[model samples]
Target chain A: MADEQTTLPPDDPVRFYQVGSFAVGNRLQPLDLRTVQAAQDRPNALTCGHRACQGCGEALGARYALDAAVRATDGRLVSVNATGCLEVFSTPFPETSWRIAWLHSLFGNAPAVATGMAAGLRALGKSDVRVVAQGGDGGTVDIGFGCLSGMFERNDDVLYICYDNEAYMNTGVQRSGATPPAARTQTTQAVGPEPGNVFGQGKDVPRIAMAHEIPYVATATVADLHDLEGKVNTAMGIRGARYLHILVPCPLGWGSASKDTIAVARAATQCGLFPVFEARDGEVVASTPIRRLTPVDDYLRMQKRFAHLFAPARRDDVIDRLQAMADRNIRRYGLLEEAAR
Target chain B: MPVQIEGSQAVARAVAACRPGVICAYPISPQTHIVEGLSALVKSGELPGCEFVNVESEFAAMSTAIGASAVGARAYTATASQGLLFMVEAVYNASGLGLPIVMTVANRAIGAPINIWNDHSDTMSQRDSGWLQLYAETNQEAADLHVQAFRIAEQISLPVMVCMDGFILTHAMEVVEVPTPEQVARFLPPFHPRQVVDPDDPVSIGAMVGPEAFTEVRYLAHHRQMEALEVIPRVADEFREVFGRDSGGLVRPYRCDDAETVVIALGSVLGTLKDVVDERRARGERIGVLGITSFRPFPRDQVRDVLWNASRFISLEKAFSVGIGGIVSSQVRASLIGHPITNSTVVAGLGGRPITKASLHAMLDRSARDELEYLEFLDLDRALVQREIARTRVGTRSGPAAENMLRDLGAVRSTPH
Candidate 1:
């Protein structure tokens, strides 16, 4: 089964490109491909002082995703927020971090609500305005999954984005349907013989979305701003159900350094733990290839949720099992496209 | 023109006449026929320009209505007991967000053992959800209420629940003088949303109102609901003038001029209660009927003004508040607080059991003697209840309480054919 080799970054100096100079709006660059974040007048859909935990990957992901959506729609966008970290942290009852026409409904109903908003807009002949529904992992994969599937099946004209940080970060880091195996969560404690979360428990919502045969289904990470932004732009170009899943690293829940948030997300993709890909109508269109593959331990070692395997005595079997999962994804999706071939 | 039709179909036509642009619903009995009729009309091109959405669940149906209503499209949906309960969260949301969505609630009983029969328990459980609840006394009234629901909801920017007795009114075929489409158009004006989703003048709807303003927002809803008591009769007059029918109003009274007793109730049971009152009046008794059309705003002042002279009133209703006796009776009693009418509740026709005229007469007779209990189950099997009680006393599980009673009495299910 192990026909392919996992290669770490070479010992020699490697090539580097202008990766994130355009992290903010590249005012110095041409307007055609400029990021909304670079534009001085860009709509900061999420403004300041969100109560998101320090180095919150969710907050970063939301801003990137929504800012791009706003730009794509030419500032004519309405967002429905499912109840989670984004809803609670941004809106503590009276205050809100949103600067756009926003609605915060109960958890798991954002997709349905957004579907309604889209239908309402079309009925009113305001089809030019777009709608976006966003939620955290717990809301997306667990509570709101049915509404999401319904939206896709109906081909509702709305984009549903899921910010996946593994567990229910909003409710004190309990395990959600998106939680990775062997990850320690409040509900999936690292105490029993199995240690952390039992193997093969969580749902593969991206695959589920693909199976629904929606117009677009994409997986991205907070570390890849360009890829995330491009997918959002592509989604806005289509006028049917679209799903965007972005894996974000929670500093508090993962027990990682706030400064290492982006690094953690990068390691997740580079180690083939969360294979980044895009599909259309249930068919794989393209995927971000792993430039330099690393072992699963390289990604897990940074997060405290997986620290138990390395503590006291090394749990090589647990590491091997987890590596097999990552390798399986790599092979199934052909994540190392040309390199594997 | 007067035509005999299934009450569900009649209400469907009535709702369609209101010219809702978007119709979304998930079928649940006895609410199924309404949506079925709507879908047929939609398919036949009779409902042109209407978008009929077959949603996956009651939650999606209400959510679709919310979306349509939020975007300024006139929206309507229908559901019953479990469906209503399924969409309960969105029900509160529709009202809280101030969306003018109209939904037909074919009132049925909620269940632990799972019953789908007629009862006010469904709508009763949602009385505090901040939507204006209107119960119909007959098929004609139920049909007419749908036309008015849109007008009142749109005018006040609030959702309305037009409840009719499940099966009793939803499935029963009856004579109803449904107004012509043009007449309904004139009576119920086009839905002009007070708030809309527009990029030109965008405004945040369904905002997260915190403690600082949550109480004030709820207070506004309460005040607006209270305003319906006045607006209800006003619209009813307009509806009568345009449609030439005496159907809907906050409260309707019959033969109460020289009455010493009044039998009050909601929904179709009110018609049977009125019949019993008429028979008593024929003989030498002085009794009247007060049909509470608007059970939500409660129509406290209007009811007090109508039944002011009655010495005693008995509420023979299809729904009760479990530990609290009655849902509508408490409101009736509170309305006549300063007045001198004695109050009694007779919980009847639970889970689709028939509320016969003879039972009403017996209850009225007891009320006249000043010997009626505060709360009574109209035709409860005493032996079965006693047996269950005895079983519990002996530390044994009273298994399938209702079925045990039915078997003990050698009785099967009952449905009004």
Candidate 2:
């Protein structure tokens, strides 16, 4: 149960003993080294019997992040949620899947609400209680951005976790500020000359959070449960505004197989479309190198939203543009081994 | 102690005495000084254990108060005019969630013409938003209402909006009996939330209620406001006992007994109407004034009782329904539905236009003689309105009406560049 063993060192030889280093749990590793989800008695902050879609990455991501936060705060944690799939699915009046103290304020303002909860708790001499605000990409990157940035500028004691499922999945897959380029959404149709979401737009919220020079800012994905849980834990340890932009793939919105949620998220990171990295005070301290460099097509072909680019005369030009974006990310974050780079 | 202080400062001191745990605010005209005072008190350690948050916008201020109140903290915030409109979505959310957060809306005119002056348009816009709207007639009532607002809000578990006229009350220096902490403590008990975000007994505070339960949930909110109709007066009575002054209640009837024509108004406009009524009464005109402190939970029964025997009544409104004319008068008319009371709506003091004694004397003389229109715009520029109406009829595009009116009045250049 030592603190050192809780984090799997980069050079640990035991990483290769089982499925892989990216696996959530390893039987060969000790209890402390395993992910919180691997534990039998995890808090299950976003508990069972919710109405999320099959293989919903946001549901898993919320559970992993909040359970880890609960473990870090010793069960003294409060969650403030924005009106999104997470808030709607988890609590549907007279019933709720959330076991921890939770609140769903509005479509936006979770960050400010969490800031208030922290302040209120502190004022009441209950500083031991910690706060976490969460929302989807639509909430965090677009509608709630002002409040989130304000929380960051004030450095309020709250950890805001964004479960980024790319688009506004709750509103039936409309385009959001976090929606990737050339992705077919409800608003961004696939029949036009552009065929999907336009290029040269969409927010990079993790980078935006880093620009705030906060105490902690990290990009995580549901593909790596240990990484996501670890990031939440690290954010919980900090006393100021900490942001965790977790890339949670949506099976319903992505038009992918329900079972390929983790696989698609893994392909996103492995192809460098979504960078997994950590920053402190606006400086990149570490990044998870892609173990096997994959093409952006491997990530795109799994989802029907991008199926337009593959069929009816292959849009090699758009695919190449996407690959270029991934390459740019790889170069920017150094998300590859020396030979691959 | 009774001291001559600005209305906002007195309210801040009264709020500090009540011991709010969180005070979130965004700077807006009129309401800015209230939060500024609270911020100083918090920073200087005068108000210990209080967190003063300078939010980015009015939305964040209200949202933060929602969070603080949900977590069982005594929360407070203030806004006015467009700032109130900006935070309006959260305003409804706070009340819908039944968070007992007290907010001060320094009542001002909502803009298109863009005026920063005193009016009730802002608070009237939120008359149905489920917050208990308490209008103050003077600096003393404005300060005293804060102490009672907290108690009443906590008692019924609904948000309270303590509204005072923008610059007329918020900026005016007047004698206010600011209560002591001991008096506030005796009157307003420590917050014991009906619902709280406590880890020991974890519960979801704001859940998504579907069609099956949404109506019931809203009805419950309405039921709580009805409950406030009782709690407001009880708390105001308690405040009187503790602070030794009459402050907040549903309505304050001034010389209504044996009166024929009763004048009705809200906020600081009531002070002017009361003075005008006193002068008329001195001349043996048998006039009376009724000041409505609570706009929401509308005090229907009380209003009906006061105006029941009166032959006629005049509703002097600072805000009206624009197209429909008379926001408060409409409610007053609704309350006196069966009664055969002749009523008139006098829209006055709009956008900081001074309601001088001369104008009131003319208007009241007309009202007493039954020579007033059903919907009268007191002190309106008839020529300017006529010119604009004529221009609109002649041309398809009249530019903007506000700009045109300003130009016609020589408030701006007559020629467009």
- Which is the leading candidate under lDDT? 2
The Cα error of candidate 2 at residue B388, in Å, is 0.8
Clash counts for all predictions: 3, 0
Off by over 4 Å in 1: A1-31, A92-95, A339-341, B395-398, B414-417
Report the CAPRI category for model 2.
high
True contacts kept of 2: 0.83
- What lDDT would candidate 2 get against the real structure? 0.90
Candidate 2 local lDDT, B263-303, one digit each (tens): 89998887778888888888999889999999998999999
Lowest summed lDDT window (length 10), candidate 2 chain B: B408-417
Clashing pairs in 1: A25-A37, A25-A38, A108-A144
Residue A293 in candidate 2, Cα distance off native in Å: 0.5
TM-score of decoy 2: 0.97
The global C-alpha lDDT for each of the candidates, from Candidate 1 onward, is 0.85, 0.90
For residues A264-333, write the lDDT of model 2, one tens digit per residue.
9999999999999999999988899998899999999999999999998799999999999999999999
Task: Note the DockQ of each predicted structure.
Answer: 0.44, 0.86
